[model samples]
Target: MESGKYIIVTGGAGFIGSHTVVSLLESGYSPIIIDDFRNSKKFILDRLEEITGKSIVSFDFDCSNQEKLREVFSTYEVHGIIHFAADKAVGESVLKPLKYYENNLQSLVSMLKISEEFSVTKFVFSSSCTVYGEPDQVPVDENAPIKYTASPYGYTKQVCERICADTAYASDHLRITLLRYFNPIGAHPSGLIGELPLGVPNNLVPFVTQTAIGIRQELTVFGDDYPTTDGTCIRDYIHVCDLADAHVRALESNSDEEVSIYNVGTGVGSTVLEVVNTFEEVNGVKVKHKIGPRREGDAAQVYADNKKITEALHWKAKYTLSDALKHAWNWQKNLDESR
Candidate 1:
């Protein structure tokens, strides 16, 4: 294991997971990735090696398989774990609720069970702002009560947070940090490995980039009749790298509480129109787009208070919307050339 603190990053090949892996390595930790390539590709490991100039260590298997995960625990003296292995498409989760429940819930349960068995203490969960569920107000803080989830995917995250809390409450060895991420957009600054969704893109930035790159013909604005400044839904879009840094910070911070929760976001809300416009302005590429009906599970407007995470973990988003869009476009261009 190269003689460093080993952290297990489940779903480490996915978009946010891959970026966090980079952050973990840069922060002097050895990240052991456990992924099944169900939603990601094996070539991401090569990309990681290329970006870090270090050999990447990873295993291919579903994390819900307790026996397979146990073998991994037996091989390495695991110090901590960051669980990100789950079906995360909100729209798909709505269409296939059973799939979301079975995969998202079971994988977490398995990870928690293995943690207790192996006595690995620290855990960082990849949570979402969807847990907030159409908050009554903007700039929602960590204390905000989780309201009605707009989709089954959001419900899975909400339930997973509860599962982590209850597990930690019952165990003496675990310290868990739940990071409620707002909209996570953009790619790594390296432009080597970024969001590479299979089939069709789910998130807005990817769809925008794909459209800009001609992989997709036009982007669809989900809703534009909402009561916002631009008559569209709003979100606090944080860069993937900024979000990744928060995971390292959470791992490094010391706290007595069994479970800690923080909101990771840029403390400002931007409308869908604003994001599209900003991308066009920054990349100098016209994204062919048109308005459409509201998506089944979408919150109208949600941002972050971010004071607690700032004061406690000393982490705040440092990337602007323009920077994120530019990086995302650059990543798309890189992907196009590689193809």
Candidate 2:
């Protein structure tokens, strides 16, 4: 048990960050949450306590504020950090590039500076597979050449990874691991927490779930002319729990390399149509959807070649696509009932 080893999770109240906090508690590590509630609700902190039976230690502030963040370091003997605070919306990024750049990059740089000052050694960065942009091939690996990103969101992730790598190179103590995630869907099976997007959802699963539950009138399949199995875009939709568990593994795993990179995903691609069909079949609900024009900054087909993370951190996605959709529907239903 890492009894008193306090790991700070920025954006800890958000969807993936909340789940990772649960994972951290289950693994016997004390996690302190830092969030601004810019894109998340405050009630999630209570849910975390409800799930874990532990009073969470948290601070409510944007991590980009260096002085406020420094206070956390001064108070607690911080052991490590898992940075997940960023404005993550591909389509929105195309519309508001400045918002993405300012919030995403500034938060990352602020966190990095705090880590350096506090001498927090182990760092896990929440990265995205969108860094690959429109890959030259399907099932892109960690070794794939990072081409020009399609959106400002992806550009921020790419730049953040570089910043972490360069920081690791300069520092003797900081060891950073960049986990490039593919699409993450599903909710906690307990239905206690899930992806709760504030406005219109930028991701497919939440929008699909909302459509099923009647919050959204219908779903829109972004593009049907892409060069893929069903002409719709394909993604590697791993369960959010599986993705959250990978963070714990990445934090626990040891390596001689200062900056390590891994692709955290199921090594398979499911088309947009497949996801919709599977959701209907598994949960006994139909999602009314139409073929809309292609969304900007979308890749034709992007999945993971996840052999490296499997071997290095002993991490592999456990939940199936059908299971993910089923859980997603259950979460949506749960939210509806609560309201």
Candidate 3:
């Protein structure tokens, strides 16, 4: 938690990771990045430098590589780790369950081993609201039962949360915080870093951006007959920057607990049609979207009850949905211009 303490951020080049790196530097913490560039690119490092005016140190290493990860820990004076590396595509995870398990589960185990070996106790894990699979009640909370995983990726998060808990229980020195994030949308305010989906995007905001930028044909609003107020799937779409800030706060807390779980979301839910409408309003352009049949493994509605994190960490989502959409639009515009 000290100013000069070296904090290792796995998957630091990715969307949320890059934004968290910016937050870390802004908060006077020195962050060392570890990424394989499997899903992310090196351009994010340059973008981070541009945004924070600070040179970041990064290692092109996979968190699952035990030997290589050990070398990273030995080389750097890593005091804490904010783990963000994982395979996150829900649909792809269903097709490639082993791949998700390997990347998500193995990397987390390796990271914990390294953390224990090197005596780096402070840990912040990137968990997901998907762990609360199809909550029986609206506005799901931290105490909500971790239902059956909708996809392999969601199962990985649930597994990792258990791993963190078990690891902490065995080791009295370890302090782990699991942040169950809801749908993270938008980009950094500087428009230098944003969600860069490879090939095609599975998330809604990126698909909306791609559609607006003409990279994709149109946005497909999956399932228009869900049992929601709008008859469309509703999700608590938190801003990426806001989600990133939660990591910094968690890392700084320096608690001695085995594991603490918090839902990182705006206690509000927005439907798919509502998001598209907001995108159109924010960009001042109509989004070509169509209501499609419900995709397999898709949930009807999922929003967070972010009271625990708000009270425990004193962190609340500051940006509104309008702000998120505006930033996302700006990033999309920048992407278009660069292309």
What C-alpha lDDT do the candidate models reach, one value each? 0.92, 0.91, 0.90
User: Among these predicted structures, which one has the highest lDDT?
Assistant: 1
Against the true structure, candidate 3 reaches a TM-score of 0.97
Please list all clashing residue pairs in model 1, or write none if there are none. none
lDDT of 3 at 128: 91
- The parts of candidate 2 lying over 4 Å away from their true place are 1-3
Predicted candidate 2 versus true structure: per-residue lDDT over 227-328, tens digit per residue: 887899999999999999998998898787999999999999999999999999999888999999998668789999999999989997889999899888
Q: After superposition, how far is residue 101 of candidate 3 from its true place, in Å?
A: 1.2
Q: Is candidate 2 or candidate 3 better by lDDT?
A: 2
lDDT of 1 by residue, 123-144 (tens): 9998998898889888899988
* Model 3 C-alpha lDDT per residue in residues 1-339, reported as the tens digit of each score: 223578999999998999999999999888999999999989889989999998999999888888988777777788799999998988899899999988999899999999899888899999999899889997998888989977888899999999999998999689999999999999998888999999889999999888987888988888888888788999999999999999988987856678888899999999998898988987798789888898877789889888888888999899999999999989988987987
- Which residue segments of model 3 deviate by more than 4 Å? 1-3
For model 1, the stretches where C-alpha displacement exceeds 4 angstroms are 1-3
Q: Which ranking of candidates, highest lDDT first?
A: 1, 2, 3
RMSD of each: 1.2, 1.7, 1.7
- Model 2 Cα displacement at 84 (Å)? 0.3
